[model samples]
Target: MIFEDMDRIVFAGDSVTDMGSAQPVGEGLFENLGTGYVRIIDNLLAACYPERKIRVTNSGISGNTSRDLLARFQRDVVDLKPDWVSICIGINDVWRQFDSPAIPDEQVMPEEYEQNVEQMILQVKGKVKGIFLLSPYYMEPNREDAMRSRMDEYVAVCARLAQKHGCIFVDFQQMYEDYCKIRHSTFIAWDRVHPNRVGATLMARAFLEKCEFDYNHGNGEVH
Candidate 1:
């Protein structure tokens, strides 16, 4: 596994990462990690690698853009001193351009979004064991669609940063695009943003794949 025993992973992002996770920081007991992929990852880690006591924390806030996350990155993410930091922002940065077009200042342009994400990465690069950069995705499979096309630009930015920083990159946009090829976007997310349980599971699986998670690690062992 990419993560060592007792390593702590903090997931920081927007609503998709939030999904009812505790305010500020969420971890330990109950649904503090929210009902999203963060929780799923925690569940699977504990289930399959029972001996590895990896800590999972969620610092996601709904309706936040990259700009917002950057503002609180230090307090919410850095101060915690997690072994691994997973950033899943940029969705709202693109969403505002379409949903609230009238509020020009509210929108986080691609350039600004890239700067914000890069700054966050720089803050934790040498301080952590590893980082996970999860791209912001629009569920629309049609590449030509205005929103999806705009979103692709952000994904490219994430890919670029992840490579430059030597971070583990999870291309969620491409993952959903592949899934949408066989199943409609509505099957997972109706608005094509907030994912249902199935979509969250798919995301968890994709993330674990990058982490070298062994689903069969506990196989043939008596519980």
Candidate 2:
């Protein structure tokens, strides 16, 4: 696995990452990690690499855009001092532009979104061992859809920054697009944004793949 023993990984994003995680910080026992992909990643890490003793933290906040995430980056991410950081934001940035067209201030344009994410990466890239840039996705499979098209723009920005900064780019938008081909977007999320358990698992699988997680390691062994 890419993560070293006792590596502390912090996941920062919006509601998709939050998914009801404990306030301020989410970690430790009793499901404080929430029921999202973050918790799934933690569970799999423990089950597959019992000796690694990886520490996982969820710093996601609901309804947060890249702007909001940047505002709290220092307190939620930097001060926490994580070894690995996974950022999944920008959904609300695109959503707000379409959902509330009248409110210009509420909308975070593509240029600002790109800058906000880049600034966050610049702030933490040197401090953390590595960073994972998970693109903000709109679940609609139709590329022609206005929201999905706009979301693709943000996804491109994430890819560009990930490459420039040497961060791992997890193309979540493409992941959902592939899944939506077999199953309708509504099947995973009615709004095609906040995923249910199944969609969350898909995300977890994708993340673990990038980490080179070995599923067969402890498959037949009983702890």
lDDT (tens digit, per residue) of candidate 2 on 1-223: 8988899999999999999999878999987999999999999998888878899999999999999999999999999999999999999999999989999898999999999999999989888899999999999888999999999999999999999999999999999999988999888888999999999999999999999899876674744
Given candidate 2, what's the lDDT at residue 197? 93
Off by over 4 Å in 2: 218-223
RMSD, one per candidate, in order: 1.1, 1.4
lDDT measured at residue 173 in model 2 versus the true structure, 0 to 100:
97
TM-score for predicted model 1 compared with the true structure: 0.98
| Candidate 2 clash figure, as a count | 0
Q: Estimate the lDDT of model 1.
A: 0.95
Please give, for residues 122-212, the per-residue lDDT of candidate 1 as tens digits: 9999999999999999999999999999999999999999999898999999999999999999999989999999999999999999988
